[model samples]
Target: MPISSVEKDLDALTMTIVAEFPVPVRRLWDAYADPRQIEKFWGPPGWPATFARHDMAPGGRSSYYMTGPGGERAGAYWEFLAVEPERSFEVLDGFAGPDGTPDPAMPTTRMTCTFEETGAGARVTTTTSFDSLDDLQKLLEMGMQEGMTAAMGQMDAVVADLASFAAGRAAELQILSDAQVRVSRVIRGPLRSVWDAHHDPALLRRWMLGPDGWTMPVCEVATKVGDSYRFEWEQEGGGGRFGFTGELLESLPPHRAVTTERMVGVEGPGTVNELTLTPVEGGTLLTVVITYPDPQTRDQVLATGMVDGQEMSYARLEAEVLTPA
Candidate 1:
């Protein structure tokens, strides 16, 4: 068991759990920073988790759900209060509805996770403060301690497996739900550069082309929340022309962005794409949570080899735009 101690202070209305790992602090921190890695052990053994959004920055929010053995789900969310990279992070944790809204009936807690170097390796101290003694007792009765212990038990394997989530790997796709999917990649560039590459027309025209024979004829980028952008591509010999248009719904420069995307000439509901970028051990972790109109639409798009095209474009971005000549 990685958990060294679990302490509950009734007077302070807080519970503290300390877990030590046989790895460096950076390794332990990265395991939590990346949604792909953290989701592996965020839930207990039988109840696996899928994170739809995981933005590890102050004022950001993360929403995820755990699936039970019977296929039932329990959703939760974290509103980040502070983030000190590789050191500590604090969040307001609470229950969430299926739509990811906060459950007003459930009690919320303030939790802080601190990382430190230990003689053996590294240690993580997680302290959760409840609003009242009743809240703390209520959670304890709900098997909170047992759930956490079981979840942390699986971290040993995740932290040690570095190759799976290492840099230079191609983009990965995770189906978050019937209508949502998350595409993730570790781009070999700084966070700002990756963010800029998506916005600057010149930078985008250089690498947003998916295949070797394709050329981007139009590259209009949305600069603000209400701005709309369009992009069109064509084959080298002037055949196979297509395009996408979208309106920027939200923009948090260099960290996150949300946009509504649809085919330029298509006549149907569009998809909402939420993109988040975080600095990690190897490079910038880019995550895009896309919400399709429905399961059919989601399947249709994925069936078109969208992920493979995205991988090709990202690889090109690294080799052409981000990389030095």
Candidate 2:
């Protein structure tokens, strides 16, 4: 496969290499975001490269070296000038010594890498700017063209592996089924604190609101089996109010609970919501599993931005309830 093409403009004092990959932009971005992945394809096929230090952020520095056939190491360093996730970044590339220090005698190239999404997949354009024509020619004479071409050529195989791994990781995180929608979070506090945030009316009012400019005006929880609870959120500008009322079916303090939730003005029957908490090393792992009566209802709830709303609410709960308590 044609992976990369290099273009050199001596008069323009620039060298640009563009590569196309059949992978998601995020997977391609991981080639640079992860140092371990970069180490695998940073040099020509035979001269393997190893990174001593890699900090992928604006103003950060990365130091690495390539080992030759005779064990000769060619060290290089990059000073990151700017960084934008899944998009582009700028860096100053230069030769370095074994100690990871920049060598003043070597020419430095200003490099910019841009990642763009396309119909086919993702494309990356890396441009290197030289100070002068002589500087560009000097690097070319040092086998820069062959080195870069061979290095970037390895990206296709690397991206394929990364894409597969990313897909597997995403599948593990997604929680969607015919009858249920599940969400989980690790709250940065003890299990009891997280449980209290759900049962305590005052604490419940602080983080249960769905959207911005909404306040949980009324929150009541009986905290016992066969008991009922109700929560209402009123918009700030007198817009409107919405809430859910439920009956507790099972209660196991600070660990697990089962309840039923019915929207204030919804049409069909409510859903069964199961809440479980487990103690982790430093906090609590809270999981909420909601079983809908049908697939249509489950899809409707998902379409209403329920997942995003819950994520936002969980963030607030962590900051306000977990942190303060």
Candidate 3:
């Protein structure tokens, strides 16, 4: 109820984010109401929660199947608080089940997300509180800051694209001048299996975007640093115009892959992306890292439609690699 006063009233107050998702509190509240909405955006990026549950109340607990690339499941939970619908909900992690039962295996923290109705849209302020400085530091050290910031940017795009149970007219939205939106997926799959989906021309054609009616004629990958690859996609059949290309930055067999991508329409080769694959109990864990070499470019893309592409791409990758065939 007393927001700004949270600093004076609470012990060890922490500040993290303020995001405009282009949706009002009423509709944004709906996402919290329905379990399906939670299912859609629960994972970091490119990963889907295989098994998800939400009680949606003050005393409830939520769970999700953290399906990494190649189908490895890591479980996560959240304990809810202050359950006011469409207005606010606060949650903390590292708590035992409904009862006092304890589990020391997992690291935990607390989170508070408040929704406000603004003329601009629903401004969501999320605060991540830690039991100890160590917990907060660990999250930052593990790259949570950059990733969450990008995820919020991705959320704003989703809110913009949604058909108006909540919608902010494109014109009303202040254009992003410079902002970068990014997402990462930790994938665990067999090196050969992951490689096949990436290297096989036919398989690659199934996922990558196009201008429609595109065909892959030349898909070459070197799989090692300094190795160049060319991907040519065309619609006119013989001698067409569409094409995309990238050069290998570094490739670690069954371990990791990095590339610099260049497309036909874009300014130049942009994005130095890395995919690290780690072997898990029954599958391979693949982590995708996308970087914008220039800060200005990153900020510009974040302000523009870059996030839409990132979110859609992550969803597509989840479909292609994480799901069971």
Candidate 4:
């Protein structure tokens, strides 16, 4: 919704769109880098764009098609002329066929997108230069201005959704008593994948661990009622080693799982951890409620930065396992 104005320069044979987004320059740039994120808002309302392929780099090619209200499709391709990460990029845009072949009969434009950091957020400017004044007018008459405005507006929602998963942003850490702490993350993956990731040790080792350099060298899972499991991890240099063994109290595959967790090398009461995954648009919402035996026990865990550690683990899971397959 930070779109301010669309300007057309007849003498210069160009069109420019100016907008602001309350997110970091890197985050905004990622919207352009990820095709899945781009497809969410690459076209105007009711004309959703489907990207067949996207390679974001100099000399790279991206192919996509937009479906109109009446089911008609318009395909386009971008020949990336230059790329500069979170700074600026230039691309040659033109009409194309379903097979991603460029159409020589159609007009083309060279467009450059730039991003700048402001005190409040990031400012984005996009300028497209046509071959001639006549071509510029032709695109304007085709509602290019209004269509792009609407498409850019959808980016606000896209960035917001990304921010929701910004490591602990989706979770609320609450201390119910001297004995309970809860951590939740809204994962953007299907319920089944998330469920498997939690219940399958082989897949869990990929994302469920401490910060970089730490490894879950031991993971055993038996996700069944009355079954048991164990997890062991240590820092890269063999320092700060810790692990936990637990018994499964409840198991509802792809939905809910409960276990009694007892930690080693720590003097405190074991905790009851319940993990729940609920289906939601674009992914699943995961909530883990940990109940300690006493307020002293809860405070002890909090002092260990458990919340931040779990948040980091979930963030990794989101990037590696939660992405839509």
Candidate 5:
């Protein structure tokens, strides 16, 4: 077990757990920063987790759920209060309903996690403060301590598996639910560069083209919330023309963005795409969570080989836009 100690303070209504790992601090931090990696160890054995959204910046929120042995699910959410990148982060943690809404009846806790380097490797100290003594007692009775211990026990393996989550890999797709899917990739560029490539029309036109033998003729980009953008692509020698139009819903420079995307001439509801970028060990981790209108719509979009197209585009981005001459 990696856990060094677990201490509970009844007078202060707080509990602190300390764990050490034989890895560099950055490696340990990246495991938590990347949703794909963190989800592997967030839940105890026999209860795997799936994170639909994981924005690590302040004012952001992460929603996830754990599936039990018998197919039961327990949902939870975290509201990021502060993030000091690779050093520490604080969050308001609480239970949530299946829909990812916080359960007001359940007690919430403020948890602060600090990372530091040790002689051998690194250490993470997590301190969770309850609102009251009753709240602390209530959580302990619910196996909170045991669950945490079990969850951290799996982190050692995740942190050691560097090749799987390294940069230069193809984009990966994860189905969060019937209506939601998450696609992730690590770009060989900085966070700001990746974010800028998505916004700047010139930069986008250069790399956003999915496959060879195509040209992007129209590249209108949304600069702020509520602004609409359009993009159209045509095959070489004027074969077929297609495009997507969307309105920016939320924008947090260098970190996150949310938009509504649809086919230019389509009539039905569109998907809400949430994009998040985080600096990790290898490069910038880019995650896009798309919420479709329903399961059929989700399946239809994936059937078009969307992930493969995305991978090609990303590869182009690295070669044409991000790589230094």
Candidate 6:
């Protein structure tokens, strides 16, 4: 989607960005001024963020929300630079520790944004300057500046079709494979009810594969220390079913369950699965953690992904726990 005649411009001896958005300068200004709007679009594709403030005036500060791989939040702050209403602004962006204290080793950048009204719409020309050419060269080497540029591009498009962009990510990849499925759901039911449902083979059949077809080789253990089991799984497709042997190494009954599984197939070495159930205000929060030995296995597993096999197991757990009598 690169357009010719990109309206490229530069400032003397410094790196710069020049582009036009669909909206006017003032509208773009508001998007910068409003924290909520900033969160909608900003940063590179696949990278998520949040805006804590948009102090549009001088001496105002802003915070950014950053999430790591497992959805854990990492945040930081930036101090505002020159600010002129709806026209231009600048800022010194840095990496602050979780406590919001600036870490001096990570130098801040000076960013300048100028808005001009073009017939196409308002054009935004953002130029970022470092203290030295060496610094600028370093950032380019680190892929920092280009990342921000792509992020701005993503934001501009997001401003127009938010819902469509979201749907595109959530839509099924539409792949057909004889891969395994793991489904999971959290149920806010009583502990006793969930426990009873789990113990009953009839109720288990409703959510899990009935004992007739699948091997329930694992079961019958105290929900206490050193408890465990094994399972033989056959997928819907015929690529050769796999067997998994593991145990319930630890348990805080009705709270969390720790299980380690070893795969018996050419596909994997083995992986550990951890399930946590924390009682919430009304419902219990269920989490499934799968630690893959290598990135290759992770990628392979995702290629066959639908409802992940572990997630499916959690779904079965939820059904047994929450189904009403």
Best candidate, lDDT: 5
Separate clash counts for every candidate: 0, 0, 12, 1, 0, 12
| Candidate 4 lDDT by residue in tens digits, 197-279 | 88777789989895788988889997578887889998877877789988999765666677999986667569898776654
lDDT of 6 by residue, 134-209 (tens): 6666667878766666667765654454332221122122111122112223455654555545545444445545
Error of 6 at 257 (Å): 46
Please list the residue runs of candidate 4 whose C-alpha ends up more than 4 Å from where it truly belongs after superposition. 163-325
Worst 10 residues of 3 by lDDT: 168-177
Error of 4 at 2 (Å): 1.4
Model 1 C-alpha lDDT per residue in residues 104-153, reported as the tens digit of each score: 99999999999999999999999999999889989999999899889988
Task: Give the distance in Å from residue 130's predicted Cα in candidate 2 to where it truly belongs.
Answer: 0.3
Candidate 1 worst ten-residue window by lDDT: 203-212
lDDT of 2 by residue, 1-325 (tens): 5355788887788989999988878778877755546767889988987654455666666767898999888999998899887899899999998767889999999999999998889999999999988888899999998888889888878777733333111111233346765565666778788889888888888887766788887788967799988888888977688888889997767666789999877777999987766543335556577878999888888788886777777777877877754
How does model 4 fare in lDDT?
Answer: 0.78
Off by over 4 Å in 5: none
Q: Per-candidate TM vs. native?
A: 0.98, 0.52, 0.43, 0.52, 0.98, 0.45
Model 2 TM-score relative to the real fold:
0.52
Candidate 4 differs from the real structure by a C-alpha RMSD in angstroms, to one decimal, of: 16.4
Off by over 4 Å in 2: 163-325
lDDT winner between 3 and 4, please give it: 4
Better of 3 and 4 by TM-score: 4
lDDT of 5 by residue, 1-325 (tens): 8999999999999999999999999999998999999999999999999999899999888999999999999999999999999899999999999788999999999999999999999999999999999999999999999999999999999999999999979999999888999999999998899999999999998999888989999999999899999999999899699999999999888799999999989898999999999999778999999999999999999999999999999999999899998
lDDT of 6 at 107: 56
